[model samples]
Target: MFSRKTRLAVAIAAACSFNQALAAEQEQLELDAQTVVGSADESAVDSYRSTPSSAATKLDLTPRQTPQSISTLTRAQLDDFHLDSVNDALKMATGIQVQEVETDRTYYTARGFDITNFQYDGIGIPFVYGNVEGDIDTAVFERVEVIRGANGLMSGTGNPSATINFVRKRPTATPQARIDLTGGSWDKRRIDADVSGALTAAGNIRGRAVYAHENKNSYLDRYSREKNVFHGVLEFDLSDSTLFSIGHTLQKSDSNSPLWGALPLNFSDGSKTDYSRSTSTSADWAYWDVQENRTFAELAHDLGNGWQAKAVVTHVKKEGDGSLFYVYGTPDRDSGLGLFSYPSEYQDENRQLIGDLQLNGAFALGGRQHDAVLGASWSRSELEDISWYDTTTGTALPPLEDWSGNIGKPLNDAGSNGSDFTDRMQSFYGAARWSLTDRLSLITGARVVDVESSGGNYGSDKTTKYSGEVVPYAGVVFDLTEQYSVYASYTEVFDPQTETDASGSRLAPVEGVNYEAGIKGELFDDRVNLALAVFRTEQDNVAEMAGMVGGRSYYRAVEGLTSEGYELEISGELLPGLQAMAGYTFVDITDANDDHAVTYSPKHMFKAATTYRVPGLEQLKVGASLNWQDEVYNGIAEQDAYAVVNLMASYDIDPNWTVSANLNNLTDEKYLTSLYWTQAYYAAPRNASMSVSWKY
Candidate 1:
């Protein structure tokens, strides 16, 4: 067995040696390739172009013309960073944090709140079992957009954190194909392919298909995963000004690892340091598995009368089975004393159906200018939860190392615990944008939601349906110059509690309001986009107790909680052959009712990356990045801070082929990726990967 510090040192050394070797190899290859092709057309710059910034646009407007703070991760950025999932894509974004909640699950937070409000191609996808197991793949996306603050006018229900929207890749009228293969440490292997082209004469119809497969192992014992994703889309042009598109995606993940909880924060006598990294207290547990299927259809038509109507329908089904295990007790208070363990086996199933309709265009009001939008949406979700417990077990399970050789047998004909049940939600909303002047705009929106929950044999009793407030929003954008703009906005969001009140009725919804102000600029031929924003969000009238309960389930709210933050983002091709992206955030989250700083929000977080092509080496590119955060407290006891670096180099083998390598966590810092005192998840050890890609 290796000590934590020893392991960290070894990983760092390996990463450094690997990167050195790769750099040498890439340089040699670049020299050989340039000799053969004589550095063909170094000034061919057609590949870089600014598409619409999906993040800033509310109605398909360009980023410079929009009124808010939006950050976008382009496909080039994704490839440079070797991003394989949504978690990987947002890792270095401003104001965003990714925390590994379990071996196969991750949580994303923005501005001190969980950002579970996700949109696929501008449409909301219903999710359950938290945000960890949702069926989303980075392979099918062209870019990812993050809108900082509330977006009630677009998404009906959500938190005030941030909204993450995935923009799917669209088929071009011309034919194209790409294939990529990657291999790295831990026997990791990945394959991704994309094919798109016109499917009919006159280019009236176009279609695309994307596929990805990944298999990998982790440093932890008996921890591994395999995943597959497939996506398809079809687009048809009804007329010059009208278009229609439809798409669907399927994702499945299989893992051979159980949920591992956090570790202790301190040793005896209130010492700050405690626990060994390799100490696993439960090795007899089986792994958990999740399967998800989703399908959707959308239609957009421009009436040619300055009006457009869009409709969307989506369906999702998800299922899971396995055991979840965790350790519980006061560690320092009872040093060297083994605490109680929680182990449970269960199965879950969820299904959802949603529909949305919207109409947008321009209207004249008192000879002024007005761009208005009206929309309505409804969704229904059904959940079935089942579990079985072993009553003969002792209060404490054997240490993880001790059980390694004595794998426990599955309980035969396990006793059954009745099922738990819950239904979905229904909502309607409308919004409009009014341009008071050519340089000023005002936006307003509102929504109404109704929700209900029903109990089963082992779940809570039935709760009658309840309605929530007509949430409202207003915003103003003032253009100081052609290249500069200032904006301020305020929006409200509400989430209805599924539990019953004193009279056996659904409780009132928790209401949250977000206020934000920001400035935007476009410099250097619209190549650089810069934004700075300050925001404050407040949530009131929250339920007291809601979350995973007794291995069962529960719900509650933190009454009067506030999260405030400042953020800055810069993204673009800074120079002809140089491109850079960076983001920084400072947050102050507090429990307003108690006047205490929240436990998980880090005060300072920042990420920056730069990629440059060598002045005369047209065939080679090199990039590096740094991500850092200030100390964050764990359960009012322990605190930890971390900084990590990444490096990459790529060489064009020919017009049709390229080779690249990436070194992740270049310094191998030993730190907890997630913690709740007594429970901790370590960051990934340094790893290296080499990839070969071909395009035609």
Candidate 2:
């Protein structure tokens, strides 16, 4: 797997070199003709609803036309809310939930299940839990798109949660530059730079680049993090009707004294620990580090006659290393001890290759205009993990005297064999939209997917395959008026299971079906949008974590799991100079036994934000936000209901200069963000940041 990745990297490098040389020569020889200038497709929107998306069906469509519950976080919104990470953006999206299972390991879910499917620019990619790929910085993205419920029509395989799509910022024909510097509580410091413009004097070639760096101390004692990222892209006009582009990104993150798990909820005698939120479970010697790289290339051609074809290729490589200690065993309140340490060290790498081609155009069918798309895609992901564990006899050191963060680090001498896993998938998909009438439309799509996974241990060697799985999707939309539309959609997806039955035989794959109906409306000349949707999902062959057997934990298959939910969202500008976004979600989950099934999925969640410009003082703006969630549980531990409020203020010194201040947890609310099976994680306390931004 490593060799394959190395070869691919070298090939891409050579291609990039050749492209650059060719571009330079073309620029020198055809300097006068290269004066034909091009502009970026992106548009600045004053309201959330002004942005159009292509994530739902891989077609340029508004949120109301997608026939599903969709939400977007625009760059303007991100700036208003001070969202720095992908996790932060998702948390603000409608009906979405995020949890920090461990330090630097955040997980996302929608409806009632974990989200495992992710896409970049409408292309599918692999996502795994406890991987830093899920928590990368969001500075390079122009916006984030989310589709609620099953999305099998576009994503070949995934859980029934939701699909998240990140749209990258494109190069601009007009020269643009921006810089920001920030200082905040907890000794936080950050700097960001973005620049985009024509690369050649004749304006035939364009380029964009983004760079960001941040270092901060955490609320938890003895924990600190540092991160740096760089992204660059170049676009060249191969001809009047063709375009070529290539991009690369590099990001690195390091967390010192990172905890493996949160503090315990109960003591050894079954008594509550009631420890302070500032308590830490990690030692100074523990750390976690991650480095990731991505390279991509694209070619698009306008075939003329209202037809176009596009091909894209992307490669991602992520490497992680960690040495950590977990504090778990029940504690003894009387003796001030009962906890034990499980120390280990590990190194892992994940590599992925994805390619897709699509031909889309408008055609006259049966005396009416229709849109159709034919596409094929191939993707593969490979992962390898190597670890060393502490093998001391008794596995118990001296108990802590006062149960502080002064635990000693143990030696990791015991060796463990490495494990490797690989997944490959190929699919053919097609979709078409028929304009039956000016007010009604019918859209249908399907994908035939062939997927296989192999590799476990060097000796054990296990494999799983699912061939010829057909996932179908359909939707209907009726325009009640120029501003209102009603729609319904049905979609399905499947996941191959790795869990085994009691007899140790692999279980069948899980299947999911989603039914949705919604009413959408656009107001203020399509500058404001609103949607009310109700959804129901059914799953068969669901996998659940089972109790330990043979001194190791395992998973089992369960049947008859259902989740029903409703979402309400309103976004965009109610009036000029005033922007707002509000959302509320309610969900209910039932298991095979007809009981409350999901422990981590909250039944109620809500988020809202608004920004207003002072009527007379056009240069001053004020904003506020609210985030609330109902109580959640993991096994016996429960996280109580919580609500937080944030406030922001900004002053535009001039057209090119601005200063802003952000205050989080305005009321200083104390809450728990996650309740894992073994421990509880607390939310951060009140914090504030001030920044100055200059744009030209």
For this target, which candidate reaches the highest TM-score against the unseen true structure? 2
The sequence of per-residue lDDT tens digits that candidate 2 reaches over residues 551-632 is 1224577788999989999999887888998999999999879899877778999999889988999899999999999998
Candidate 1: which stretches are off by over 4 Å?
1-58, 238-244, 267-285, 330-341, 366-369, 400-405, 412-414, 418-420, 456-458, 462-464, 497-508, 541-556, 676-678
lDDT agreement with native, every candidate: 0.68, 0.78
Clashes of 2: 1
User: 188-241, model 1: which lDDT tens digit per residue?
Assistant: 888787766556545566677777878887766666678888888887776665
Task: Count residue pairs with overlapping backbones in model 1.
Answer: 16
